[model samples]
Target chain A: MSLLVVGSVAFDDLETPFGRRERALGGSATYFSLSASRFHPVRIVAVVGEDFGPDQMRVFEGRPIDLAGLSKVKGLSFHWKGAYGYDLNEAKTLATDLNVFADFKPDLPANYRECDYLFLGNIDPVLQLDVVRQMARRPKWIALDTMNYWIRGSRPALDAVLKEVDILLVNDAEVRELTQEYSLIKAYKKVRALGPSTLVVKRGEYGVALFTPDGIFAAPAYPLENVFDPTGAGDTFAGGFLGYLAWIERTDVTALKHATLVGSVMASFTVEQFSTERLEQISQDEVRNRLALFSDMIRVEDL
Target chain B: MSLLVVGSVAFDDLETPFGRRERALGGSATYFSLSASRFHPVRIVAVVGEDFGPDQMRVFEGRPIDLAGLSKVKGLSFHWKGAYGYDLNEAKTLATDLNVFADFKPDLPANYRECDYLFLGNIDPVLQLDVVRQMARRPKWIALDTMNYWIRGSRPALDAVLKEVDILLVNDAEVRELTQEYSLIKAYKKVRALGPSTLVVKRGEYGVALFTPDGIFAAPAYPLENVFDPTGAGDTFAGGFLGYLAWIERTDVTALKHATLVGSVMASFTVEQFSTERLEQISQDEVRNRLALFSDMIRVEDL
Candidate 1:
């Protein structure tokens, strides 16, 4: 069975110390589908404007991604312009024209509703909840990603969605903000109580921390000499993780660690270029080799 | 075999989100010795003052640590007061009093001269160079740790010593500062070029990363529910690492990975309480079990 991803598909104008780009193909589902498509078949439900031309949307054409639920509206596509300086962790928002995405009411198609996997990318909790309600058959596994925006603006809605999902993708600071706890372990416990049994806190460049009732696991990011643009790196990470889990058809302890590393590897590739350039072009052999390198890098034999 | 640790032994007043403590047994050599002494015998070469009374100095007792080279002067011991806000990565120094430590010329005891492993903690680079010069027999493995202060203030001296060291233990920021490079991998390469064949960049709370001429390895910190104080976590890490190498009598690729995890485990315990209270009392079984847990956390089978 395939994975169903619901989030924004938009254009991003980005600037970093390395260079700049204007109106590149960007957004949560756009990135997630591309990265996840590398491993498992992916379907996206997102809204785009008429301005988002056929050529701009061709990044998903040759991949195992179904755009059956992608909506092309009359207005401009959701557009965001941002910049990064020394610290790639924080994005400086130059402007955001959420013309089409502002009215994003996710409407899942028939095939989409029957999928076994679902990813509610960073979006309005109300919309995320609506998609959950539209599913014809409950997915085997569902992971949700939310930003600080919905947590502060729509707590009740966020809380309602949290109880249904199997995992919540959060950043270190956002986790603290969600639970009002400074300590991450405390934050992890509090966050799990809100919804998902599996909580993965993305720590930007440092790495990601995984928490389950069984125990906790921390995974480091693939160390890079340069990070061109950190934009969409998180979504790409989710894509890798969910994609791997979908491919393996298991979410056990070993699979969780494997997924976490794949997520980090995908994210490392995502930041090496603007938009999904690296993610789209990454070969299976390159991924296997890189994963092997990572395996060697962190290998430990018990004493 | 034992590790020779050279640095200050001081009193620390610390404030963190967990709580506060005053003038507790602190300093680089003190923490390193305490942590390393658990695995292999550790000989400390540094100076304290008469004010570091019997009760205050009793933390080192009942431990496999040699104090033959630890000097006691007539004046007060070196004192440092620091605070950690929401961001535990940075230790905001509120006070620093270098009393007897100011005149410390590491007069290594004759027996200390034949050591195989040497760890030079964050101190004046010039003093570090002097210790290297005074060694009766060059150590088999010499790792160096220097602060941003010496990097900025004593660049030439730091450079001179860097050329002689086997490895350099740098925190992420100090490496960035030393090379004027924001990218960690690039910074690691630049630091390696300056000296030391091996480089380990310590990312607080995140993890410790190791790089040799061979390849790179990344190890995550042991997840802690609470990081009571991060004062000497890095030193403890070095102690565990170097001490383990001393015990195993190896620094091969597998050995380096093993040492990295041991370092992470030791640092984890150090952060659980103020000063070296946790490190001073941890059992071998506890270390073995914790290391095993970390081994499981980062485990990945070859793809």
Candidate 2:
């Protein structure tokens, strides 16, 4: 079964305490596609620009990623400038040139209609809904990720998409910001009330907690000795989560727990270096080894 | 075997968003003794004053808590006044009056000297060492909890106690604050370098992470609808952890994981209301029920 991912594919200028990179390949869809493709077949629907060079495009040479929906318009790609210091939780945005992404619309490929799994990455919630509308057949599982930018401003559209999503993933502060509730559990309940049957609240470096109608599942963020850059780690996590589910062919509550652990491992790797560089380096066995350790970290005796 | 706890048993005036409590029965040893005594015999080594009323003393009437070392001196008991806004992470100290506690000494009863498990709650490092020195027989397991104040101001004494203790439990920020390492995994390693073979870094509202020579174990914080007051929650967690360990008669890696979950349950109960009131209200059945749910929350398919 194939996985369909839709969001931005852009050039990112990032500065961190470890180092700096100019025009590094990044975007919600880019990170999501790179990670999900590592596990299952991925079809991406996103827009780039003429300035997005072939060097960036060649990153797809060996991966099972169908880029038929990746269109190159005659303008600059979505370019974002961000910085991180001692605290990796909050990214300082210096600039954002929406460029070609400003008027972007997701146009899913015909083959994408057959995808068994779909991920709506962080983007305008209205566009997220548009991607869902374009789907020829409803995927078995639909996971959506959105940021505070949409929750605070485009909530009506966000709520519309939330009503349709199987899972809604947001970090700690974003959940609080969205619901205006100080307590995380309260915030979680409010999100569930808005319609998603399952909620995955990402707490970078702390962990990811999943709430389902059956019950709750919590997995700690894999403790890392170093986190070089946090850019796109969340997107990478969403990809890893949906990718694993697509491969296993299950989206039950129990399966989501495994997905959360898989996502943690993928995000752990992404943070070891900037952008999706680390995600590109690890093999399937390496991913398996981390998953095994992660599984061991939470092994409990049956009561 | 009995569990030995040593720290100040003081009165606290606190203001939280829920409400305010004046001169509440609050202290590390007070909370720890209340939680630990539920599982095993607990001996408290702390000082109060003539002003310490009979109502506060009756909290231990039916429990297996030996208050032989709970001395009532001539002056006022140690007093603390603090406030918390919506953010319960950082408590703001409005005033502190360390009347009798200023010149206090822990006078452990002869029976307490032979207890098998000893927990040194958050207190002066110099005083913590003194309690160990007073012990005629070394305990089977010694768990120590201290704040950043002692970690920074009394490194030598803290180090001395750290070398002797078997377990060191600290919250997330304290470990980072103590080791000056922003990365939690790195910070865990640094704390292990200084002393204890087993370390539990508590993440209030997030959960507990256990680090041993063997490796790492993670547990989620028991989700709560409300956290009325967070005062002494950490101390209650320490009591729950050591209490379970004392009952299980082991401190191995596996045992520590179970103990972490137990502590989480205990801490969860403590925060439901102000001070130790919630801890006093719940029955053994409620604790076991919550622990069962907690175990179920992380139960996953073997990978």
Q: Per-residue lDDT of A1-303 in model 1, one digit per residue for the tens?
A: 779999999899999988999989899999899889889999999999999897877788988889889989889999999999878889999999999888889888887878788999998999999999999878888899998888899999999999989988989878888999877778878877887888899998888988887778887788887789999999999999999999999978778888998988988999999887787898999888888877776666665
Per-residue alpha-carbon lDDT of model 2 for A11-122, expressed as tens digits?
8999898898899999998889888887898888999999988799988768999899898888999999999978788899999999999989887767777767889989
Model 1 misplaced stretches (Cα beyond 4 Å): none
Q: Superposing all C-alpha atoms, what RMSD in Å does each candidate have to the true structure? A: 1.4, 1.5
How high is the CA lDDT of each candidate model? Answer: 0.88, 0.88
Fnat of each candidate: 0.73, 0.83
Worst 10 residues of 1 chain B by lDDT: B294-303
TM-score quality measure for candidate 1: 0.98
Compare the candidates by DockQ and give the number of the best one.
Answer: 2
